[model samples]
Target: MLPAVAVAAVAAVAVAVAVAVPALRHRLVRSALRRAGGRYRRRLEALSSDVRLNQERRLRRLLRAGTGTGTGTAGGWEEFQQRHPLGQPCREEAPEDAVPPLWLWALLPGCWDCDPRLQGSLLYLDALGTAFPRALSRRGTALLHWTPGCPRAPAGWPLPTLYCTPAAAGTVPSRAAALRLQLLFALRQRELHVLEAGLAAELHDALVALRTEWPQLARELALGRLSPQPGLPEEVQRQLQALLAPDAARAAELRAECARGFEGILQRLWPQLEVVVVRMVHGSERLYCNSLLQAECQGLPFYCPFYQAAGALLGVNLWPAEPEPRFLLCPDWAFCEFLPCLANKEPQTVLLDELWEGREYRLVVTAQPGEYRCRTGEVLKVTGFHKQCPVVEPVRRESQTLSVRGEDIPEEQFCQSLCRTLRTWPGARLIDYACVESSLLGDFSGPCAPHYEVFMELQGLRDLSEGQRYKLDQCLQEDFPIYKSFRFKGSIGPLRLHLVRPGTFTRLREALGSPRPMPRVLHQEQLLQLVQGSIIS
Candidate 1:
């Protein structure tokens, strides 16, 4: 072993290399990119004016229309229940495909008064056919899902186009990655076209730079030459092997190196823009990934697993759909049997046995659409009735609940406690949260009981003093009766709270590289990985 002084010197040098080198590299790259990016940004801004105007106009129209409309009992679940209120042992089953009249379906968002379910709703014509004034592409299949009454295209507006490279959907993550990348590419191209031709010169130049780098960068990414990074999209993955060389001893190290390299390339290539990112959740449903601005800066409301539920309920009263054409609950949720939701304040699980006029159960639905007793896994608190129609606010997912030592703590309650705790401290906000069963419980020799380690990201606050932490603990206990009982009875240990830096959730999600939504609760191994990856303890 080296002398203590020598060891200390070596440690200092290693730390310097790890931190200083990255900082230096970032500074250099930023300077280089800024020189070229300035012109590009200016040009893009000029081109985007028309698109912005168009978007503004459309938004105004939507807001006006939404505000003008009222939610009626004509299309709500309660109304359906009034028609067929019970699920009996021998009663005739409602048809799974039971949809409201065509006129009603036309009222849906993006429906634009046109029936989307009708045969030949989309018209696919050959480019060489009489409909085409000029050929747009060399060769490819096309598909269109047409809706009427969408903001009418300007006179000179062109038809939309989507180009996809077919790939096998072997797993959810793989499928999601492919779809996301393709969609992202399509969006960039669409936005590029939306800008004014004269103002797009600088942007066009930037694209030229992109065009030059993309091919080589993509190739390097595919071959693991750029970086041995993980979580790269399928477009780049298709060119290379999924994993590094088959050496178990160094696999983790090699993969980490690759992931770093891929990240570096992405930072260099991806344009910085103020935009919201969304990913598909469970088929066609879209969910937003909390933006960096929302999480770290403004603390604007964004959907987390818990928030998804909490917000829905708040929406019922605060953003009532009735008397406001804009607000809707399950606007597209038709032809389904609602089943298996829980209460807002309790853990009692309810089955979709029947519908009463004013009672709200969890929104479980069974319909000819696909499955039976399929719990949408959502909780709903019913508001009032529009006629016999049920107006419900979404609560949270049943899967978000955590159970240990007979104590069940729902994610919604967890969020409520977190928000309540933060509210007491002005300027603080809760960004994201997760919990894991404590692995250290085994270290205690006498009457050891497992507990939870709660991890959270807070904006505009740091250094959670003991008193503040205690307040948080008390709030949690107050919110969860079972948890409080478990804690008092010595069935569980004191809750451990960990404050992580802002954007920690974003990093975790990116590291996970899955198209699936980030989970609100993590198991032991997952939690360990998250802690390891986090920016701060």
Candidate 2:
């Protein structure tokens, strides 16, 4: 009777234990992970602390040595501002002054790569070099970079990105072709992850296009090796054939049946995606975090400042060290000063304190020891301080102002208006846009006064109504009171919106040539062919 009682008690305990296991498993695992993540962050913070402390004092020492003047680098941040006045290019010379100060090239120190004048690039590259080894493996970074066309020759560095004029030549067609190429890459190297692109806008556009029209492409974008296919689709077959020639094609010929990347992207969840390497976010958005629409979809971003030259990296978005990329500025190289009056030909400048936060300033670069402080015309806003280094981000260019009637509308605000207008206009995604001052067209004596003329390139948008055009003006008026006041006083005419031919911007850039993309406020009359010709009755 006692043995029978013992067996019955043992069975009861076993049943209770089984019931507890299901509820306790996930809680136990999550608690352990939270503790581990906390320890990792604490360790990283300690390592960065010392580097953060030395940034300011070291920057002053370098400037003193480069300038060769003890007093030039002396004094508080405010005193430094008093010593060097702002330097701006001549208004008549627009883009000509915007070019590199090549004349000062002979005077700068530290070779071309390490020049004191080119401090922005120096700090940027230094940060990247230090972090690259830690964040990535030398075996392969798993960089999934995109190209406009396929190369005739195999690329060794940055992997020759091969893309060409699409079987069709328009922007949408070109992007569609490139999307297929990326999918082909995704098919190889199962464990490899990280899709890269030059601009965030381009990558976002490509993915959106793929998901909308050719979602069947997902099974191919999966992280797996080449599979037995009845046949490759004729649309993207040739490009894939050219790219994935078997036997570990070149670079270790990483061959694996990689089928898992975009499968859940459109349907369910994408927890596996690592990071999307984006070189720069455009001026359409103020902060990098807010700008990356692609990152919102499931990918982390490896953000870098705009310059692409070797060793010219600036801005900090240290990936693994910081959980999510900060995309914060607060560079240790040069200082920034607020432009007292952007309208004045001679505006005094005041250097921002290295520790100052929550203020906007024009970047006053200390370039070429002998040269005056360059008023880079780049407006940067200091959001907060990471120790002594003030965290900042590029706000907009002073040159992006459309101030024909003293109602200076900055690029950010103009973009805001554009954003509002696009939401109401169905099926239009921006390809590019250029703002033209109405006075540039020599119609000052017309029934209307000087105003803004916008030439835009769009995908999936063919027709625009007068009411739709006026909506932009309404948005602008709501955003900028000065602009509204000008319209009320009849000093500014109604804003004109023009939809240009496909590839209009591609041709415009080709015509403008390299190194000099005339400011947003276009002036050259000859450059207005497609723009003016697109005017509707």
Candidate 3:
């Protein structure tokens, strides 16, 4: 009889424990809901409008009613989910009734919650005032980023789109700004191509016309010879000065001209679209090398100060100790799905389908108005994941390498070595530089069959000494293991460094029929082209 009693007691205790556990869980969940509900109420009270306050109150009620542990609450939540599913229509023309339920709204970008209509499009504008008409034309939904100084959006911009702009009339809160600028560049690649081509042609034609007028200068440019000029004409000197010196003012003027030209095109293309301007504390948005929309300028990857700033604003560390220079985020991952590798083991077989989110790969992208699997030649590392999207950092270019036999020195490694060495010389600024294979020039032949020549445009030359140069060489050897081995074996000659004028790179770009910044790794063929175009002193 005692044994029977013990068994019954144990069974009763087990049943009690099961009931108690569920009760405890219910109590905790309710406690959490109450706290959340209170916080939402406090936030709601801060709203300046009765309508918004009422909406918040209603939203809170829905949360409280739907999120309880009761059977009725679970049923209510399920019904709500059915009404506002995650896979609901994602189009610009989504109907008014298609607004996301209050529960899902909090998790989305803040702009989406501002208006029921914003369910449709996302538009992001920047200081350049250029909109992606090609991309915009296709999507009804967009997130528009606007700077403080950008012009107001023209009427008839599709409703239900979120505009994340500075604190101004009709601007979304500052907290809702897009995290990456690559989304803008990638989405608007079509427009970027048009602009890049137009600018390059304009600049190229202008140079050709200048050559026609100044025949001697023209002849010098054509021959790529920089002979000591006994006396140059004032106009020719001015032109050469513009090309060779770092003229910030002149750069600004050219940038402004390009901006104006782009704006004019936009006005003609879509008069209803207002250009969004992105302003930061430094200054209003101005054109830079990244504006060219290529993956990198020379060996350096495409970088935007705005991207860094946005990351900082969000309290996220988006950059690494060393620059990766990759595309961090794209809204539509499909756009990057078809990018081909810039370099393959076999030159003839260069097409590659995707860059995995967590590895280093070459970048090639397809843009509309007809660009498909265009090899950008940019090397990028997948830094992290932005949700399911990959955050890429541009490291270097596939073409930006110096190879002598099996010794390969990549542009990123060289740049890093240069940076490390430059740090030893405080206050020294690197204006520009170019690297080319020596065999292309035929200046150093025989033993130096495949060598590299680095032309540096350095400012503040006082600190440069023989020891520093040796250290620079040592840094390169250390950075590139293969280079060190080749140097030790005497298979490759010592890398030669020449200090060029301040604007050598700019002049090179202009002479090369490219308005965009010149690549750091100028191949032998490009060097040949420069020599043919006339060497700017």
Candidate 4:
């Protein structure tokens, strides 16, 4: 019985050992597997991040090279494709048929003003056509598929077909409404493509939210009524308000979603496109040439020849010698006094006046038929003057007097004033001048002329080069002049200026002399310091 009990105990011990050993081995294997999986995931994430970073850098370079005076052609396309290689199928596709080809995509939408609906629709379409290529190019085409609506499909459009719901179709009331629907649809398509392409799940959700909000805003815009305003036309306000209601909660929600989505998109897209967001400053000031003298007094404001000529043609109301004068003095008193004296059956004289010690004096002036008095100051009493000024060759005056405030002058004058104040400084050069208008926003209303704002592009002591050009651009950005009532708006390209050479500059200085006075040297010194600080870095 003792031997049998001992055997049972040994058997029990052996069974216990078997169970313990297997359990230990299993735990070890499980731990090793978990560690390996964790390392693998980390490695994958790092690789993805690096890949995205590289792609972004390449895209940024491409965009920078393409903008502003670069050849935006097939070569640009080739370079882009080479940098961002498509997969095997895309590589096999011909240039004409391939979506990535620059020729296939329209960079800017066509001008279509007559139909508001069509215009809105086309604008969205153009944006998609332009942006999708870049997105897919970066993310790869496997994530995207194109589809067209039934109407488009019937017309043999190459994109993937997406059906517009009957309810959605009915919701669109006007041609403009239909256009907006199309735009939203295109945006939705792009969003899905981005998601499918393995973008973050959060990005997809944000985009979905954004698309849903667009339609609600559009509906509100369509329903809103117009109000009276100066800058905003009634029709425009009505349409815009309905589309983007200021108070609507849905609109705000949509805006937030869009902002989030766009940021994500930009983060991904910016690097690939090589896009640089250039900061632009706008101004509001009118540009005008000083027209005070001619011949002996050429370009001088306070002198004769020009002034006398102006007076002979148009009756002056006040003479220069008058004490407390009320009117300009002129020889053509008959024309100033309303007598018909010109051969063209028109009056050639007008009156100019100044008020001194509460008394008004009249100065007679004669001028060509087209010339009109632009001076504003004191009231003048004309003994006799005529109203009719016919368009004929009566007498041509080379220059006329211009009244400017003590503060206002050409950009050159400001620079010169500063140089004069700092007599020790080297002379400055007028490198460039800009009559910048107050907005950078493009106007679809056509080519409107610049307004009151003007900026003088002056070069310091630095030599001219591409680097210098860049520095100048930077300096302008930093030390930009501030206008209390006017702000810088937009840039008009290919700036043209009647540049004055060194000789011409000297001539102007000699002509103006002590009368006009040189610009303050201190002002120039300050400007130099400001420009140096701005551009040097």
Candidate 5:
């Protein structure tokens, strides 16, 4: 009743002020709608946990017998897993098909939307068809065109071009196109339900591009700490300004909530630019890995389990209630929580049911159509669990972990150190980065000592001083105790950091195909040569 009375009072004030300030009336109404929608969505999320697993089961049934016949909801998953005890691991050798297992079906259920009931409202960085691995992919969007029950794309969201064009093949977007699309998506949040994009690296590029293209708006939203960037639609410019009020309290609040770095910049432009990063394992494109939500942004490639989108199903919200569970895996989609029978001979596998928090596991999937079992080279660590669904963090790719001299620093720790170093560097919006173990270097490249070679593509801070270069080495020491020990013992040499030419990664991505992502950990000499050639003085 108190809340209702307060809302009523606010409404009364808006009406009373409307007569004197007609222009501001629409603004107040629009703000009210966004707030009200937020409240409604939160209410839905609160109720989602109760029915999430049910919805997932419903989805799995629709995945077509891609997992094979004889599998039903009743203890069938256990039986199926026993029969296919082990499957082949993901390799560089390409498969005949790269589509999601669901592609076998004529039309993927439109429920991948926040809810099947809410039609034509989803807007992603790439069309679902365009998303590599194509989890829900094209058929999902095509349904919106054919079925009346399917939700239609909302006004001003650009579904046809954004969804169907040559641009649909995502992974790499040209700077100019990326900036325009990103700015458009940032403003569209006033109405849409969810806005999905690729990994953290790609999202950083978008945000950096956002600031580069619209300095004034970025400055005001970032509370002037970050330098200015330019160009935007007038209405969008007004909306972005509205996000940052002139009042001291609001400004202070913004400053306090946002400090420095991409994380801070993200907070400053949030709600309006709520971008979620989807991290799909590179080699195995058909399997959905996980996603990083706006709240859990760590400035790295990490995410909550893919099926946990229960908020969209049960609550229609981006966040979920406590004990956050994953929607049940399809009976057709078998998972392995078992340990590998061999040692370093095989990758580490996490025991899902008996998951020990902080321990890493190789995420395995049999979700692809006609595939027996494929051990995803991706590493996911158990963070927490909701009911039976495990909440996981994609730690790193198994092959990406630097193992020279047995220091074996995981990618996440390396990323954490890199991010920390970035915060201290001047004009840092780390666009794309790759790590190379000295082991990849040929005998002629110095003594071929064990160390790390890091290549970075940054938007600002043209060059680094000796001290700035040293910070990365210091940071890596902090992240990996063994690495520090190895350095101290002289077993490992110092880490080398390089600033690469702008568009180096872009050109590399183009060479790799628009749908393909650049490898984060460069193991091959060929890939290193391309990066080496692009390094700036």
Candidate 6:
């Protein structure tokens, strides 16, 4: 009986195992097939088909939307794939009816490695959407590349699409192109709201001021009469007329006053426009202008004081132009041609004995228009009809010395002393100087040489006189006599003074002694010059 029971139990266990093993294996096979098949393959295939269908429908819709049918649908599939290759379906956001109609498509090509200036301008455009909703609504959609190194479709791009080179993108030209596109779009769309009320008001005020100051020019412009150039817009023509009036006497007086006023205004506005102009021309705007004018003048002319003032405000030096010797009536196009030439000319000129102190002098060569100018009532002598003569001023030399100690002084203390000393010197007005650790000085373990060097730069000289140089020398000598040797070097007409040795703390204290109502004036007459002795020869 026990043996029978054991056999029956073993049979029962075998039967259960046979049933469970097959069921488990079947389940495992099914999971393995699913895993090997690819999780997203089916889904992606379905999505791709839907995307292709939608794209086909969109192409048809786009064709129907246009007044004329498209030429053909060749390469349509490839084009669609290029745009949406991943087969990702665009989300269906409400029906097309839910969104406003698109009036314009702002198609932008790849902007990889765009310039910072262009980026800033694009941001400005983005900001404009807030100010002018209609300008950037469904009517206008800014389309930029979603991926790097992808080119935008030329066909889908809105009319008057701005095609910028990868190199030019994020540059001044890009910004200018954007501005032009916006302006044109606004005009075409009849969306004047893009020009906010405040901006319009400001523009209106500017126009009014211009007209009031230049009534005759304004009248000519309004009348559509060509005061200078027939091709120029009347407003621009009027501006030119005001700038280059035929009446030499009146024009001179007006220009002088305008220059003074413009200078003041530019001091405030230059910061904004500098980047604007730079980006518009790419880096080549000035270069292009210079090339154009090279044949006519050796350099550009300093004709536009307004632009100069703007440059000043931006903290940039305007390209110096050749001065006009005797005023002559030239065509407007000639004037335009002259501007670029001056911008490319060298700013510094060596004074020859013949040219120095002469009432009329020739520029090193021909100059660009709106670039060269005589210092205060100075005149240029025109040798030929288009020749430019610049009034050369006497070359002035000024110097200053700074003393440094053999040991590196605390940065704060050094800065304070330097500032104090600079404030005292008349000719040595500080023009943005800084102190950085110099490897040369740091390596110099000598008793006299310091671990760091203090560099000083001066600008806006009242006059380059021997007296001024002497005064600067005396100030430095008296302040820090330890660093007796001084070295001077720099580009342009500005002077640089470097005291070679470590300055004494006590000497610096003496220089800063007592505060007075006004700082002591370092006069030109106070400088001492080093004389070469017979023994040296």
Task: Return the top candidate by lDDT.
Answer: 2
For candidate 2, give the lDDT. 0.49
Give the Cα-based TM-score of candidate 1 against the true structure. 0.43
lDDT of 4 by residue, 1-537 (tens): 569989999999999999877656644533433343344323323433333333233333335444543433244333544543321211111111122212222312232112212222222223232334332222111121111121211000122121221113212223223333333332322222222211111112223333455545434434342233233334434444444323344334444545554433322322232111100000101011111011111221120101122222222211212112121222221122222222356333222211122223322221222222222211233333222211111121101111121113334333333234224324544432323222321362146433222233343543334443333333333333432112234332222112222222222222221112122111223332332233321
lDDT tens per residue, model 6, 302-327: 22111111111000111212232122
TM-score each candidate: 0.43, 0.58, 0.40, 0.18, 0.52, 0.21
Write the candidate numbers in order of decreasing TM-score. Answer: 2, 5, 1, 3, 6, 4
lDDT of 3 by residue, 31-109 (tens): 4333433443233223312332332333334344445533332343224335433221112111112223334343243
* Model 1: number of backbone collisions: 25
How much is 369 displaced in model 4, in angstroms?
Answer: 6.6
Candidate 3 RMSD to the correct structure:
26.0
Query: Which residues of candidate 3, in runs, are more than 4 Å off?
Result: 1-122, 126-358, 364-375, 443-449, 462-466, 524-537
lDDT of 2 by residue, 1-537 (tens): 569889899989999898777436534533333333344334324423554333345446556767687844556554545665555542322221111332334223322233322333223323443444222222122222233233211111211121222221111124434444554444343433344454454455455444443333434333223333332345455434554434333122211111233432521222334544555554542232243443334435444433311112224443323433344343433343455443357555544343346666666554334434565666766677554445566677677788997777888778778877899988987766788887777754266788888888777788788998899999999999989998999888899888887756545543453223234567677677645665442
Task: Evaluate candidate 5 by giving its C-alpha RMSD to the native, one decimal.
Answer: 13.0
Candidate 2 residue-wise lDDT at 171: 15
Lowest summed-lDDT stretch of 10 residues in model 6?
528-537
Model 3: ten consecutive residues of lowest lDDT: 308-317
List candidate 6 segments past 4 Å from native. 1-120, 126-254, 258-421, 424-428, 434-438, 441-449, 459-537
The residue ranges of model 2 lying beyond 4 angstroms of the native Cα positions read 1-84, 89-135, 138-191, 201-273, 285-314, 319-332, 339-355, 427-431, 443-447, 506-527, 530-537
lDDT of 5 by residue, 109-148 (tens): 3223222322111212212212222222221111011001
CA lDDT scores, all candidates in order: 0.38, 0.49, 0.38, 0.27, 0.46, 0.26
